[model samples]
Target: MTETPTATKEKPAHRSGLAAATREFVLIVVGALIVSSILRAFVGQMFIIPSESMQNTLLVGDRVVVEKLTDVERGDVVVFEDPGGWLGQEESGQKRGSVGRFFEVVGLLPDSSHGHLIKRLIGMPGDKVACCDAKGRLMVNGKPLDETSYLYPGDAPSAMDFQVTVPAGHVFVMGDHRSESGDSRVHLSDTGPNGGSPGDAAFVPLDKVTGRAILVVWPANRFDKLEIPDTFKDVPAAAAPPPDKPSISLTPPPK
Candidate 1:
């Protein structure tokens, strides 16, 4: 009897299309991750507070979101690149390192070669800003402000005095922690203890404004939209060459 023909079995063929689909899926995921990283690096970023210079408003260890949009108005909190040095930081480390400096050149870094700074917009180009009239209030274009809503409990409006007209294309900035912060007031060449060189007092260019800090996204309890203070409401639009009158000063009370 002839043996029955051996049954033959064929294995399923490998599909090339299936492999291509898998590869495409992997590429898409990788591309997305890269895009997100690039946005974080150049567009908007997050930062953690490393000092108390900003105090109650921005506590140490609090994370904050910084936008790269660069549009700002008065009374906005902002993040900008740091200059060559800041209070007590090592001179070398204070300068924008490779990553931050590189971004600055391309306009991704708003604070120049420095690193980054967060502060409030007080005086804009063509606006006059001064510290304390007889009542111990910051005056912007002859308008006294009511900052009780945001000022830390018991904190003075400003321990120091300053007076200056913001230059065209520049802004005057200050920290919410007036007594603790070394802001434009301390840097005015005419107002400092020595009357030598202004401390950190320098105008920030409008183009350098990165973006207004709209919300506090971290530290769950502090999360809220930063509002424009009513104090700045009556302040006049900054004008070039304030009308020949002294706007602010830092002189101590005579004994």
Candidate 2:
């Protein structure tokens, strides 16, 4: 009634195959989890707007989807690092606990120097930006911008005046809600030496740009894809040579 030697040898081979299959299954599950974590960390991050800096365009409590593409152009809404001078000097967020903040500085968690700021790119590197011409409109490279589409009704383009040439590899940004926004113009007179003189404003480094805000993905009613504005439609590319005509300079910032 005992089995032959051939049958007994085959039993061990069957068990070996089963063990190999089980090992493969476990590895697949682990690999999937790791990939997902990385994607959440860098590819696309969800954020809630905590302030009214971009009201009408983006409201408080609205969640947005930010992509990691860095080739953003003018009139595009973008999220960037707060530059510490703007955000608190120390990390004080839920994600950046005392221990986590320490690690973030040493490359443990994400860099805490990175902060969340959303605004529109008005002027790119090496471009001349001025505000309030004869008709009270913002101008770039002698071309007036019609911000009627995005500018909040009843609000002027900007109450505080600014005129500056964005540094090489930097950008000039502003908020849709001009009156409430404390953007590049707000820091023109910062105590720092690099804050720039009365008429000029500090520039935002290109490396600080995190990503472009491509959509308002939360709150079904507010969901929509963001598009580049026509205001920059007639405006020439950054590489184009400056026009021969003179571009007016708005009132300089306070001394």
Candidate 3:
């Protein structure tokens, strides 16, 4: 007698093309967002320019990438939080709907330049910074800074007089549009006894500096890398403080 034919099990059904495609799309989107978020949170972030403070170099609508990977240097453009009451008014007037806000949050759009200030790092801790010498230029650590390369046309180094020495762990910053920027100069009790003042309002603590503006990525025509001007690189370190004189009275001063 012939043996009974063996029974065969049916293969499992394959997933529909549309269903598979949708699942893959969702996964790709999720993965892309994760990478973007990581890059934005630690490597770099994007910010929109809100004012003319950094004009000529940065436009009002320009988008810039601020990198957190390096130490800030004098002459580097930095984005920092409002040191106390620096931002008098909301610089950003962006009115976004739910979708816009969502996109910004997920790193798909640039952040509003709100609650932040961007300026050129001019004076490091202990560096004596002053404005308007005989020829009318900024003096940093006794060296005149020739700012013609980026200073807005027809503007003076500073219309106001200020002399300050950046205090320890702080920096003095100013906008390229000196006339329009309400920078360290605006908060000076006098510009310390005001470097005691980024000791006061104008001097920004290193902690407040979120990142250095590394590149302009928007307004295709305006894209460029931000570099430390040669003038800043050539600035000499602050002179050493003079030693105190010995006491003339009977007892020596306590150490």
Candidate topping TM-score: 3
lDDT score of model 3? 0.78
Model 3, residue 224: C-alpha shift (Å): 1.9
Candidate 3 per-residue C-alpha lDDT over 1-255 given as tens digits, one digit per residue, 9 for 90 to 100: 899999997654564667788999999999998988888778888999988898888989999999988899999999998777677564643646789866766788887866788999998777777876777788887788999998988888888776766777788899999888888877775233323312266677889898999899888988899888888879998785421211011221122
The superposed Cα distance between candidate 2 and the true structure at residue 121, in angstroms, equals 0.6
Q: Indicate the TM-score of model 3.
A: 0.81
Q: How accurate is candidate 2 locally (lDDT)?
A: 0.69
Residue-pair clashes per candidate: 13, 0, 5
lDDT for residue 249 in candidate 2, whole number 0-100: 40
TM-score of 2: 0.71
73 Cα displacement, candidate 3 (Å):
0.2
Candidate 1: stretches off by over 4 Å = 1-22, 41-43, 90-114, 190-201, 241-255
The lDDT-based order of candidates, best leading, equals 3, 2, 1
- How big is the positional error of residue 119 in model 2, measured in Å on the Cα after superposition? 0.6
- The worst-scoring run of ten residues by lDDT in candidate 2 lies at 241-250
Tens-digit lDDT track for model 2 on 106-141?
Answer: 333443323667789998875778776778888876
Weakest 10 consecutive residues, lDDT, candidate 1? 84-93
Could you tell me which residue pairs clash in candidate 2?
A: none
Summarize candidate 1's per-residue lDDT along 1-255 as a digit string, tens digits: 899999897654566667788899999877766776677656776665555666677776566767666567788777655432334452112445788755544434333313466778887776877767788887777878888777766778788666667766667788887776666665564322323244323665566566666667767988877768887777787555633222334563222
Candidate 3 local Cα displacement, residue 8, angstroms: 12
